[model samples]
Target: MFNTYRLIGAAAALALSTTTLAAVSPQDAAKLGSSLTPFGAEKAGNAAGTIPAWTGGITQPPAAYKTAGQQHPDPFADDKPLFTITKANLAQYQANLTPGQIALFKSYPDTYQMPIYPSRRSGSAPQWVYDNTLKNASSAQLLDGGNGFADAYGGIPFPIPQSGVEALWNHIARYRGSYIVRRASEVAVQRNGAFSLVTSQQEALFKFYDPKGSYADLNNVMFYYLSFAKSPARLAGGAVLVHETLDQVKEPRQAWAYSAGQRRVRRAPNLAYDTPISAADGLRTADDTDMINGSPDRYDWKLLGKKEIYIPYNNYKVSAPGVKYDDLLKVGHLNPALTRNELHRVWVVEGTLKSTARHIYSKRTLFLDEDSWQAAVVDQYDGRGELWRVSLAYLKNFYELPTTWSALDVFHDLQARRYHVQNLDSEESSTVDFSQAIPDDGYFKPAALRRRGTR
Candidate 1:
């Protein structure tokens, strides 16, 4: 892991030559509602009619979903798989399958399969978010290369993205709920099918999504997050607090940790990049936490256009209240029986490590769901240019917030035959609370971490 000082020094040097790109023109921005979805996705369905047109997405919870904390019921529960792609028929679907996905079939031909379902353009954002996104199309600009964004507030930074980094910025700034609280678990499953769950109660206040906050009010800070471990006795009471920054070049992400054993709070600068996630047991990296996070300075990103592919989407079943983690987790991959894949158009972006940069992943190809601007799949390659890890984000619409976000994220290490999954909370009494009140700034300060860690 790069130490804090070194990382900061590297960021400063990279910021010097960071090219500034102009925002989309007003003429192009005008296409948002006429020919594109308000979020900049194509408004019409594909010529083949495989992917449906975007109507206003599911904005209200089903009648059965009566409370804020209940598991999200699948609105498309009655739908059936359109087709199943297995090793035998993999060649027929090669055009839609990512190389890393095809590799999965080759590695586990007997068990790996993709049950492709009809595409549903179910991703939606609040009306205010849509309005702000339109404003951002002509205002948002990348600063310090792509390490920072300016002239943007409360919505996707670059809805009509002109570059790969801008597309990533949209994903990074996509609207989830302003405030949320949930109990979830992370597990590192070994090749032998053995695993232990590390449960955590997490709360987050997305300053970028705050309806009242403006670009000036952000002060370079994007969000404040607090997470406290609740299980695996040894990890209980351990907590982490993060102040994710918008312009990391100006102020690197501020993070602190409270160790139960020491009963003390300490700065945690190694929470970014290839640093092994402690709870993940080295199976995943810190940058891989949310499919992708932190600075994009280490790699030169290129927009690879869009393609139709099978990606995990509207995955309410994978997060059903009573589903056991054991049933979802398997040796090589998550149980395919519970996984749902759909054919949707995704914006593909490739990131290759800059010669001056340092990290484990030499190359990474990320697929962002056009509807939500969230990464659905990331294929990571190692130093030798060999495929190493595949990360998948299973998404579902939190209808109350009416936002599409990850229900579960999995990182599969092909070489080790081990995988780590986060956001598994089926066993918890409550799922997620989107209506949680916004927390005071003081609640997320470093000093308060010590008090919150005494769990």
Candidate 2:
């Protein structure tokens, strides 16, 4: 097994020009991992020590990939920034450093800054994808899903262009859901802070009749798994629940325009997810997600470098009929007339498809859009090393909410030209942010898959 820390750690040793591995204190290393960057300093003309702007330039594509412009990476010997911050030098560039960046750099010795890459529109990628990218890039942010389940579940805040509104939407997407609602305060919760979320059904909102009485302590929280674009029974319906965003909301939230299964608009907490985490395999939070156009043994992921990628927004005049805004990640099916006619992009990821023979396309490469951290397009190759599938994501505008590449549609060139689309954004819900605590759900459990129709 590739030891993540060891491999990355050894790279540090080599860069420092040391023959032996340098033993950094675990506490310091952990601090770096939490907030510090993992890059080195660029000694260009920053005597003023300005926080680095687009050193790679603005929204223009590189003239050529190999010719250097932005693709040329000048890696550092150690985890530092192309720019460093010091008390004396902080005046000029302080504006650019995020509060988190300033604190971490001051606290740790080798704290680095996350390198910034040029936007996908940097004059690279296919021509057609560019036209659409410009139109959709704006208005991209998170929203609320409201009590993602049950009768009282209604209304949500989404696609808020204003940073303030967007921030609140993100707050809703992150906190509201079926969970251990530790405390519900009037403000935001931190990573280590205690708070509970509504769950996927089986509980109702606690009405405070007496703050200190038996009603004060409740066992369940009401919530639901908003089905974005869950595949048909053949593909396994179980893929629906795990990646629930509307299910994750702060206090204020919104709902999808259409809810397919019910033939009527449904509320949050409609379908509950009540189970134990001990039933799942070794997976982390946000790992219990659905697969798009996948087979039994064909899902291997690798972390690649961070590359700027441009993706489609509201470019296409067409609309996805059965999905919602939140189901962008797990698409169901798509109309095949589009061809490779959708959006194209420049992404950064090194994930590969599993080597199993079950999946027609045994090899896959994911391209993630950095501006939004969305996996926009994918190249799927068959066992024979042939390009078998090409997947594209289509996003929609939910009011003022951010233009989300909410839907992922893939078409296989091999076999019968069969296609599968995983719509993480079904238009019913948008901004599907996987909760930090959900890596513990047992939805992927063998027994749950066997239960069929359990959702």
How does model 1 fare in lDDT?
A: 0.87
Give the alpha carbon lDDT tens digit for every residue of 378-403 in model 1.
Answer: 99999999999999999989898889
* Candidate 1 root-mean-square deviation in Å: 6.0
lDDT, candidate 2, at 158:
20
In the order shown, what is each candidate's alpha-carbon RMSD?
6.0, 21.1
Superposition error at 177 for model 2 (Å): 10
Using Cα atoms with residue i matched to residue i, what is each candidate's TM-score against the true structure?
A: 0.95, 0.31
Instruction: Please give the CA lDDT of all the candidate structures.
Output: 0.87, 0.27
